[model samples]
Target: MGMGVMRIPRSAFIWISLFFITLILANYGKLVADAISMNWLVKYPKVWVFPLKDYVSLAMQWLVEDATFGLFTFTEATRGLSWVIEQPYNFVRALLSEGFERGLGKSAVQVLPPLSWLTVLSAVIALGHYAKDWTLAAIVGACFGYLAIFGQWDSAMITLASVVIAVPIGVGGGLLFGILAYRHHWFGRLLKPALDLMQTIPIFAYLVPILFMFGFGPVSALVATVIYAMPPMVRITTMALQSVDPEITDFGLICGCTQSQMTWRILIPSALGSLMVGVNQVIMLSLNMVIIASMIGAGGLGFDVLASLRRLDIGGGFEAGIAIVIMAIAIDRLSQAFAERSTSYVHPKIRNRIYHRHPRSMIVLTVLIFSMVVGFFIPMYQHYPESHTITTGAFWDDSIKYLNINYFDQFEAVKIFFLKSFMLPTKRFFIGIPWPWMTCLLVFIGWTFGGWKLALMNGLMTLFIVTNGMWAKAMITVYLCGVSVVIASVIGIPLGILAAVNKRAGKIIGAVIDTLQTLPSFVYLIPVVMLFRIGDFTAMIAIVLYALAPAVRYAAHGIRSVSSELIEAGIVSGCTPTQILTQIRLPLALPNILLGINQTIMLALSMLVITALVGTRDLGQEVYIALTRADTGHGIIAGLSIAFIAIIADRVISASAKNARIRYGLETTHGH
Candidate 1:
């Protein structure tokens, strides 16, 4: 008698209605499109397409050829900037890997060696131990030792030289901008979306314009690397600075500090630990771009890997990839340890004497000088002799040969099974969706998740893709990324649950995921390309390997984050372990799990540009092709399509997660 009508929130009602209407209209519109000969609705027609990419190209051209400042044309200005950037790169390279020459012109001869391997190794080990403990020092030492022992020392140092130059620049620039944003609300408002867009745009897309401005050389590569690696640092710095305790801020003000003094003396010092996290991120991301940077003449180990990949030299690629991984692990762990040191170190004023203030630095300097002196007398110490170096290149190649010889049928079967069952079907379905219908559906989803603002954003972005005649390729990119993410989540979520519930499992899985996360995107492609040959399947595997860690991490964190009281209540209710997980834990953890999915999607798209090398024809390929042709328009447009897809998915899923968190009383947000 009391069930006349049920009340629903305005949001719930609109979304519910929008969902059904979108579904019906999207599907029915396809049939209508076919009847009306409206092929534009199915595939964006070239004749009617917008020339966004062309517009972008024209602007870039003007900058390169016509724009000027003061006495210099834009080209001259850019060349000057490039020259300035190269000075540091050259100095570092000379110090670490190339060494110096005496005399001038053709009469020059080798006058000094690059820092001896032993010296650099000693420096790294001492710094590691001083930063943390012997455990970390040992790890760092072994990573460096491997490079020398395996004949990668020379190339590795070249890579290191570039990273050394790039990290400081990236971290410094990001911090400066981040502080400006934090100090000015209006600036922060303007900066937030710019950072988002910068992060979303693939590194390859920017390289086109950068290559145009700076010309092909290490300077351009360094510039691209800095741009690619800086966004996270900026975001992190703003967050960390803001998170500083208010009491600390008040103390500095009470001490009659100026605004600058309160900031540098108080807020920044208190936020040092978190700022170190940004530094660590910058280090890792800079390393991740090593291979990508190589394309623009940043030559080093990245060039080695790239050459090997192009030639299908599995052994060569594997060896270089391992070297990259080792370098990354050493740098990553050392940076993390430094972050810890930042947390624990006493203030400079608290320490007396230079030795006490920088004991590690003194030790390193002492070892460095001694090594160089001894190395001058002993050529073996100055340079690793070719005869003494060991290599695993042939071994890796042989192993691949063995696998192919022994398991060719099995490998083929697995690839075919996944392609036939999951991959192709998803690809066909996504590509088959009418562009207009897909656009409408996404707009509805955005509205359902995040109200009109998100809906408008989604609609406009989707339309841009459609009107630019990129719908087919964009959908192909979507399907590849979508399938890869689905696969990663399927593999990662379960392991995450097991890890959450069992300590031993958690330890083992955590170790594995940590290693996976440490490997750069390029490294993932080496073995995958070796076993599977060049195709979408290989790309999918590589994407999965790259994306899996986040899914596992987030899912485990979510499940473990569930309140202990809830678990106890379930036990008190006589619930089974599985039942508690299936009901209470899973429901409460849905928001976190959704966020994990969002991350997985982001990672999958990031892999797209790298995976393009394996012969996939997604937007990544578009970017790569555009890069080669120096076609800024094509690259930027394609990159925008990919970025828009990722950003839209991120916004919708984030909104959904926020709603779920609020419903569970885990958040108290009152605004969208």
Candidate 2:
């Protein structure tokens, strides 16, 4: 076998995969297809297609109107960086919803006034009781007083002034590209496949190259929410500065310090609690890219939940998707209570005699200078009046129009009993298979889970979606993200094994998977399109409630990370507790429930591209019809064929979880 590889015999590719599945169940499915003579092996042949979206729209119209670097012209250096990020996003949306004006329109002259809704609700209940306490300062003071009692306080304060300037420039450009990819090894191997193609593409394929390089408004939605919340804070600051503790870098190099004071005082204060969980995942992915950065203009509360979900107005888009889940649970519990707190430690001369020691920032700078000096003689303390607000958007559109006029045939008989028993027989058996025998059965199951370079990179990225014609909309985006990640891992792995063997059902299934992982996939398509209305069975019940919190937080953290001395050596060898939860905690929680079903199939293919605006043509409705026809080469070839089908289902579920931990020897075939 000269240089042309051979190595076939894995029981002769398991009898050629059981005679190619008994010749596709004897021609019914037709891998050996021939509609007439060979109807292009199950349909892909419109004369071998592949304009590749008019050669990526003439190389993005010559890189946005004839490229250049010297003496400007790449559209005048992106319109001078969209007028330098629209001057601090129009000075934090006019210091939180119109309060400062000068002299131009109506020959302006307000001067300043914005801080009042009782001084930004007493500075968000004194920064939620100085980050953590008084019951998270009374649950972020009743979710910042339900955005000024529901009239969605000026579009939730202009989406909290573009999430306070896109979370400090996405946590200081993810800690300066996580400290230049942890002090450069070829810049952490070219910054990890460009942060895994900026976290597997598709927040509307990052607004068609940020509306062709920041051309749209609100500084192209705050530079696509700071490049989609800076790649998980540069992969959580190069994994919290490469998990610090090497004897605190040899006691700051035996105290001779200075490599910038041992990387800023011994590895960034010993990696400030894992860089505050990457600043709470860049404040919940910049409030989950503010409802797809409000299709690139970005007003706030994701443009009032995309103009109340495009006027179907499910109670004004479920009160702007519950004021973006109460400002993402009060800024994810005040940035996780200011990264697990630390206060009472003063000593340096009583910390320079309590140098204005933030008694909740001196009571939010004395209630924002006594509500801007009583909002210059009370105009309802400077604005909170719209005829004294409070609106349940017509009481959630008259209680979902009286439950679609008395439970429209019991929600159309439970969406026709889960679409004629399981989403139209799993979308007609994945669009009747045969895309050349489902790309040679996923390239012989990625060459039986990882080999021959993942079966030639899974038969060339599943034959580039059948030569880019989009094989039946990428098999209806893999049967609606594999039946919404197998019904959210069968109802989130038994409510995560009853929240890991009951401590009151692990605090009620850990407060219902922490408020369903702080809502956002466009607020699970407004109460399942108001109790199931749209198709593909309301996009598989809003992608199984936005992929049920990573299958109940990776099955209650892989059955509470087993090994309590192997449950006391299986209770002294006479095991019980159902033989210690089915033979040692479900076979050591099957590699963390196969990494929580690979993060519930990458959050059910990123909530199936926002369930293509509640219809289902897939590849997220061709990246939302190439972001309404702007078409950056058909939205980057349908957002890189949904990032090459989430990188070939995350490399065939990480090589089938490393061949099931090397057939349960729990890994070790040679590499150490």
Candidate 3:
């Protein structure tokens, strides 16, 4: 009996202890409460709060002041760096917008000598054809044509300029760091957590420090976008390098290849598929940050969208949103095609074709030559005429007005029902939890998953939240994310299952998922506000729309990833489809689904600040307020709180997924 007792698994022991603790707390609640109320345990002093925000703000101020007034000359250095960065942006903007300026000062000659509209159109078509196929060419051409017709050429070009600068920097930096991390164990360990923090923190949080360091302008926006987009690139690169075949490495060693030679020729070439995927991710993230980047004076279509949102001009917002969507889709498709092509096996004969041999160079040369000739002849060809630009803003505005007039009562009822029956109650429950109890509960969960280390970490995080006096706001943010995730899961899982089980359904659903994932998250807020009105309900709706794609995607991926042999075994056993799904597929897929949930949660947290624009009393609102008020300390603290929450969720969920994999023998159990 003693031997058996000692042999109990740690998880079992932890659960049993939790049961007893719950019983004790239930039966003698006041006693436990009183014990926890001890000053050392519950009353965390203000002095205990790490004034990270204040410290960061002070450092930034010192840097700026010292650079300006002291001998350090940091400001001069930054300005010089800024000038270098601005050159690309200015050249691109000038090429796309002002064309060529020929005159000096007041008598300077200016000419709208940009590429002809037709020349630009033909260039996209040619590039798309080179990248993918004729379908892609048509799509790319149509998208550019839409921008021209809509008078969005200027803003779109500005965004493209920033992307052109940021993506390469992000991709290159990510690859460099990823290689470093993969090569050195200690560096990998240090880098992992930093990547996690970077990935989780709100976009606005990134802007605060960037604004301080770089000051406000396109350069700061570019820097922030690069930072935001780089983590995934780094993560993917590291994973690709690490996952390179061991046999290949051994073969390289046997062939007397140097480390550098083997890495460059073998590992990197083999990891092209993953590297390209990383590139795709970087492109998507760069585009996603365009709007957020506008917060610090990175003007473009994002600024237009923000202005429209502020003025409550649904039509204008919709137009700009459409432009953004088109841009996103064009970029996403082109990058995806490139990623796909990187891994594709091409015949040497076909590869030698003139177009295929020098696709990009040829396309650029052709466009430039054609544009110079045509632009010199036709003014409209050089610059799209404003008088001819399309305006659908009035149509959207009228439509929204009509809906508001006709459906105000119906919309109000729906809002009231959701708020009263779900949102408010959920909000209250999270906010009403006693801080000490909540902290203890989190600790218990952490202990169950990862022993004392995680428990202590979780406890410290909770303490940080409580002591910072943002418990209520934090809880509200949690509630919003929680509810959004729950609803997303409920809808997404079923849809994912349906798609996984049917080929036709999979194609259609996959397209929808792509659209959702690729569309700028901010775009969701417009239509959501139209239907729900602005409040917690609208914010929740917007978050759900924005965050739902991952749940569906992961669920489908997980289900589809289940082994064919497993399904065959069930069929051989005369099991029904339902039995196969429930007993075999779902159990095996749960880990992947959990991964999706983790992603969904992260995305929801990211959307929090954006949702604040629609009015929500959460950490997102706090960050937004800090931005508007220029309170760097408050913004940083609030953003860090959100990051902490995401980290906690990521750690706990990842541990759970690992355990699930181990139980299924998909992973080794040595760690456990």
Which stretches in model 3 have alpha-carbon errors above 4 Å? 1-51, 67-71, 102-112, 254-256, 344-367
Off by over 4 Å in 1: 1-32, 103-106, 346-366
Taking the tens digit of each residue's C-alpha lDDT, what string does model 2 give over 1-672? 578777999978887876777455435655445534675766788779787988888887898889998788887888897887778878878888987898988889988867777778887888787666788888888888888877788888888888888888889988988888898879989988777777777878768767887777777887888887888888888888888878889988988997888887778788887788888888888888888888777877787777778877877777787788888888888888887773233253334444365567777777788778877887777677777777787887888789888988999998999889998877877777768777887887788778889889879988887897888888889888988899889999888877988889889878877777777777677767877777888988888887788878777888888869889999999999988998888777777777788888887887888888888888988888888888887777777777778888888887777676677666786634
Highest-TM-score candidate: 1
* lDDT by residue (tens digit), candidate 1, 460-480: 999988888788889889989
Q: How accurate is candidate 3 locally (lDDT)?
A: 0.84
Best by lDDT: 1
Every model's TM-score: 0.94, 0.34, 0.89
Clashes of each: 0, 0, 3
**Which digits, one per residue and each the tens of the lDDT, describe model 3 over residues 582-637?**
99999999999999999999999999999999989999999998888777778878
Residue 92, candidate 2: Cα error in Å is 9.4
Distance (Å) between predicted and true CA of 357, model 2?
Answer: 33
Q: What is the Å distance of residue 445 in model 2 from its true position?
A: 1.2
Ranking by lDDT: 1, 3, 2
Q: Which candidate, 2 or 3, has the higher TM-score?
A: 3
Model 3 Cα shift for residue 423 (angstroms): 1.5
